[model samples]
Target chain A: MDWQIIVDSIPALLEGMGLTVQLTLISLVAGFFLAIPLGVMRLSSNVLLSSPVLGYVFFFRGTPLLVQIFLIYYGSGQFRPVLQEWGLWEFFREAYFCALLTLILNTAAYTTEIFRGGIQAVPHGEVEAARACGMSGFTLYRRIILPKALRLALPAYSNEVVFLFQSTSLVSIITLMDLTGVARVIVARTFDVYEIYITAGLMYLVVTYGILWVFRTVEFRLSGHLRDRALDPVEALKLHP
Target chain B: MFDLKGYGWMLWEGLSITIMVGFLSLLLAMAMGLIGAWGKLSRNKAANLTATTYTTVIRGIPELLLLLIIFYGTPTLIQNTAERMGFDIRLDFNPFIAGILTLGFIYGAFATEVFRGAFLAIPKGQGEAAYAMGMSRMLAFRRILLPQMWRFALPGLGNVWMVLIKATALVSVIGLEELMRKSYIAMGAIKLPFTLFFAAAMMYLAITAVSMLGQRYIERWANRGIRRA
Candidate 1:
């Protein structure tokens, strides 16, 4: 293993990592906000409200994000005249914006499902108790339902975030010099495919494991009351045995 | 204004390749999953650690990066090792083989967890009952454990299958000429990116829809003996 090549490449890869992290954070933040309402609507009994959200989720989840990026970045060219007329051509013309748009839209769809599951998993008895205590409408959801649902959603949402981070590599295909993109450039230049890729892979592993650690800590903190403090190890062993 | 007439055959061929890769990788992934689950469940510490490391590392990296590493790096590693052994050989790695192996290996980590959870969910008494009936371990596993494990594993496996099929699209990056690649080529040839990609997206959605229906049928068959609310 050539430690020198791997060391020299870190700065370049880190440069790309900046964009990758930015892309992930921006899309996740935007997607989370969009997903809240979409998730709520997804759980609605009204077909008119729910079906559109369902379709949005289905379309995004069904197709690969790469195709979505291509369609937005390249397909938008088909409507250049219309976009130009509406003065939106500038935004669509940039690959960065197109990639970000696709990421936000794609993540929003998946996040909607995650949030909906969390929302649905909230116990009915608790909602009834809140209602019996005069909490209703927005107040009930804001005070009682949202907190519990978000807590339930956190684990799944963390997975979604990690997956989204890995997926940010796809933006490399769209000509953005993200981590994978930069790694590709270095490999092409150095012809040291294995070492370069291994370096990049390790960088990704660090980020992924770091995220896992953070989420685990968050889960431990949030579920403190749910922990059993007095469980006997001998009894646990007997149960398993 | 897209020219499907010119590229319809290419798209069809791409769809076939996509389906082929998906099914082949799914089978390979399940095999690996079974082995992984067994390893994790086994009493040996080494087997347990090996399986744990496999799942952890594979799950941590991007699938795209893994595919690239397998495609570009494996042959070089093999050839260099061969040279060091004083044997001159050149290995021509097939992209199809690379794609299937990489995808299968990546998804296998996920499938391992699914199968492991399913194995754990099965009541211990079922297997013990088989043993008490003078059945061998293999017979007990086949007759009693496998059936119940499938019932528990099917839904999770279904979700994995859905993601696996979509993942086949990623193989196009390695130049497998799958549906996504075909769309890219067609778009370049005809200059109608929207039309070609929209067609590709529809094909993917169609495949997903069909698989979902198939999953429901299998789930129904698996659950036939169980009472549902």
Candidate 2:
């Protein structure tokens, strides 16, 4: 292993880390917000609203993220004329924004399914009780359903977060200088593909482990209510029965 | 618009390669998964530790990264060693081998969890009962355990298979001539990337849907002997 080269590449790697962190954070935040409405839309009784969301999720989830990134990046370039006519080409022209948009959209589809599962897992009695208490529609959802569903969704959502962080590496192919991209550049320069890739692998490992740790901690904290409930025999019997 | 003239044949050829790669690698992945799961479940501490380490490192790294490392790094290492050993045979690493190995490495990690969980889900009494009935350890496992493990792990394995199908696209990064790579080439030749990619996406969806239906059939077959009442 070239220890000196690895040490010297720290600053460059850190710069690459900025892109990785930025892409992962932006995508996760956007995906979370987008997931709520998308999830609801997928489960909606109305075919009009639900079909588009269904198609969107199917298209995004069925294909590989790398292909999606390529389609959004290189494919958009083919439509430069159409985008320019609408004065929207500027956003699609930049690799960074295009990569970010693809990641956000792709992750949103998966997260929406997670949220939908969580929502479906909510007991029907809770909704009926909320309605009986004069808390219907948005008010009921806001105060009761959403919270319970989110708690149930927390574990799967954390897995999505870890997946998104690992996925951010795909953006490197779209010309984004994320950690993987920087590693590719270093490999091209030094011709030490093994050492550079190993270093990059280590960097990604640290980030993934960090994400896993934080999510595990969050999962523990959020599920604490269940732990306490489990300790009470009466509550357990009531919930079970 | 679709580029029928340029991409029709290419997509067909790529589809064959994708199917070939997925099936071959699934075989390798299942073998690795079975071994890894058994190793982890073994009473031996060293076996468990080795299996756990493999899962951790492979799981943590991105599949694309692993593909790149294997595709590029392995050849140079092989060639250097070959030259040093005065070997006359020229060793050129095949992309199919590289793609299969990479997918196997990644899928093995996932299969480890699925198989281990499925094995644990088997009631302990079944194995014990079989053993007490004059069956040896291996006989007990073959007769009482493997069938149940398969049934329990079917859903998880299906999900992994779906992921494995999609992940075959990563092999295109190293110019494996898979669907994505073919689409990329067609896009360059025809200058119509959106249509080509959309076509590629539809092809992928078709493959996944068929596999899903196949999974349902297998599940039905597996559950046929069980009592529904």
Candidate 3:
């Protein structure tokens, strides 16, 4: 209800928002690329190709993001000598680097699972059609499967992106001044917990809706052919997200 | 590297607390989810709007923020209300109670979607047939709808449980000595963050892996005598 306090907090909060957005976008892009091969491996018929990816996915998805962050961030310190000898200590030493790495690894696993589902859900006929055209295995995956899989995976992938965005807040626990972190700092100083948190939550809500809007537009464009042209946009938006 | 450093009992106690928190939250979430599903599936406009708002707002915010809000907001809100009523007394949130309530509320929004989907999956004719057999509305729901809904709801509920259990880790932020908190403490005590946290991670993975196997058996039991699609 302290309207002025919420207003006073926006500038600082927006600065925090910058970090959140940075972490989310970087990790999502990195994770997506990492997931592509991981996903393909996950769907491979060969156990050797698939099982390692399975273990990676199983471990990441099975544990909490917080634990992973702590494990990577603080855990690396325990291996300082090894990391230093390997010249990897510099990377693990920065909280930002550790947080980003954790988010990337975490999102990659979830994205791999989502991508695998999308690939598996791709019609067999399509793959067969490409094969009949003498498309090589790599070419077949590139031209036929990846496109459809990406399209099919968009909604789930978008959810992952949004989740990743929300998750960037956790970086604050290790001293990254993300949006939630800024709000927490302000609240600690001012004791205006409700007002500050509400403002932060509203900021997150706006970004969440914005992400949904972008994804809906992309989804609409990607799957336009499969959808009935006469169906209203409002109706389509209601189906998911 | 695999040593627990005499903190094995600490972890066991913490794991029990973690499971307790997760279980209590799941129960509360199930209750809310059922009500939310009813509200969503109901014809009443107000009920539908309320359920929709709950899910939308909860889903839109980060779980950490929501947990923080409840952890800090509850006592403050209570005191302000009491002040307005001419009596002011401070009330502190028991971290366990706070943890379960926030997690339950958050996951309930998710479970609402799960329950709604499950309810929608049930055939209309099955309920109609139950009614035709002279079952009252309540009887039809209990005898016909609930069981079938359970079958359809299992996989989604399984996913919810997976997420919810991991989410219990967030509760550690509010001073709860759950697995994550205990791991942090042990890590500090032993100066072995990698070993302790890795051990903690495996403990979590064990919980989820076992739950998955349990889910498979439960799914089988839930779908007993049903034709596979």
lDDT of 2 by residue, A16-69 (tens): 988888999999999999999888888889999889998888888888898788
Q: Residue-wise lDDT of candidate 1 within B11-90, one digit each (tens)?
A: 88999999999999999999999999988989989999999889878887888889888999998888888899999998
Q: List, residue by residue over A194-240, the lDDT tens digit for candidate 1.
A: 99998888899999878867876777777778767723433321121
**TM-score of structure candidate 2:** 0.94
> In model 2, what are the clashing residue pairs, if there are any?
none
Query: Where in model 1 is the C-alpha error above 4 Å?
Result: A229-241, B1-5
Candidate 3's residue-wise lDDT over B4-94, tens digit each?
A: 7798788888999999999999999999999999998889999999998998898889999999999998889888889989997989899
**Predictions: Cα RMSD each:** 3.3, 4.2, 1.8
What's the lDDT of the predicted structure labeled candidate 3? Answer: 0.91
Tell me how many residue pairs clash in candidate 2.
0
The 10 consecutive residues of candidate 2 chain A with the worst lDDT sum are: A232-241
Question: Candidate 1, what DockQ?
Answer: 0.58
Candidate 1 local lDDT, residue B36: 93
Best by DockQ: 3
Clash pairs for candidate 1: none
TM-score of chain A, every prediction, order shown: 0.93, 0.92, 0.95
Two-chain complex of model 2, DockQ on C-alpha atoms against the true structure: 0.53
What lDDT score goes with residue A29 in model 2? 91
| Model 2 Cα lDDT, one tens digit per residue, B67-129 | 888888887677767877997555566888889999988898888878888898899999889
Q: Once model 2 is optimally superposed onto the true structure by TM-score, how far is the C-alpha of residue A113 displaced, in angstroms?
A: 0.4
Please tell me the TM-score of chain A for candidate 2: 0.92
Identify the superior model by lDDT, candidate 2 or candidate 3: 3
- The local distance difference test score of each candidate is 0.89, 0.84, 0.91
